[model samples]
Target: MSDKQESIKQAAIALFAKRGFDGTTVPLVAEEASVGAGTIYRYFENKEVLLNVIMQGEMLRLEQSFKENFPYDRSIREQFSHLFIGLIRFSQENFESIMLINSHTTSRHLSDQTKCDYTSLLTFLSTIVEAGREQEVIDRDLPIEAIVAITFGAVVELAKCFNGGELTLTEDLLETLDEKLWRAIST
Candidate 1:
């Protein structure tokens, strides 16, 4: 990220977090960034483009963090736990940016790559349940698709809780989410 772009992103996030997207404007972002209004135009064609870039940036960061920290060699259960914890850890440290990025995404104008990018919790997690089945650690009768959905879906909601300041993961929300998720999916 260039120095100028990063500064603009930071300012934009702070403004959106405080005032929401509808309430914020390009000039406001520029002023918050301590840059001239024209400078923002140089970086982004419009507010919508800037918002998409920021959202993509957040997903890339989380994907990088997960890719780096996850233990590929661990057992399915261990890996599942790690993924959930990783999300909470990443979100706790990056809530402001993450929340802002999340707000910028909408149902329309969302690319397939971007949709798969920010919220692939299900697709990535179904693999874990499948692994457990292969290892004979999980019952084969359960449907992997629904299991993955319920497990990962709840974690997403929990992350929302953490982001909203309604819940704090005192002992790693992953541990709790992992256990509860496993119980729901396992026989």
Candidate 2:
């Protein structure tokens, strides 16, 4: 990203954290970015497009973080720990971005362009399932598609509860849910 693009992202992150995806507008992002409206348009055709780019970057960052922490030499348990723990840590670090993702997912205004950018998350989770299957930690017959859906749905719903202060994001919670998640995929 150019310096300007980075600046825009930073501004958008703060704004989205504060006002939410639905409440925020392109004009607000342009002003916060310290760029003209035209500049924002030059990079993104509209608010939905800009929001999608932001979401894609956020998910990519999460995937990269998970990859970095999943040491190849780790035990299968350790590997699963790394995967789940990495996700929780990433969520804590990027709470705002996660909130924005949730907001956009529910937003009545979300465009098709914005929704398509979220596909990487499914792929990332599927890779984790595949790894577990290869390690025989997860069920051999557990289809990747089904496990991916289960993981995604569980994470999103649990995250909503956590974010709403209805539940904790503690390590204990992660460990318990990790077990549950594994059980769902295991034989």
The whole-model lDDT of each prediction reads: 0.73, 0.72
Model 1, 65-183: lDDT tens digits are 76676788888777867766776677688767656655655535446666766567345667777888898877788888677556545655676798788986788555666687667
Tell me each candidate's TM-score. Answer: 0.74, 0.68
Which parts of model 2 have CA positions greater than 4 angstroms off? 1-7, 10-24, 31-36, 42-45, 99-121
lDDT of 2 at 13: 74
User: In model 1, which runs have C-alpha deviations exceeding 4 angstroms?
Assistant: 14-23, 101-105, 111-123, 133-153, 160-166, 172-174
Give candidate 1's whole-model lDDT. Answer: 0.73
Q: Report the alpha-carbon TM-score of model 2 versus the true structure.
A: 0.68
What residue pairs clash in candidate 1, if any at all? Answer: none
Which candidate wins on TM-score?
1
Candidate 1: residue 76 lDDT (0-100):
78
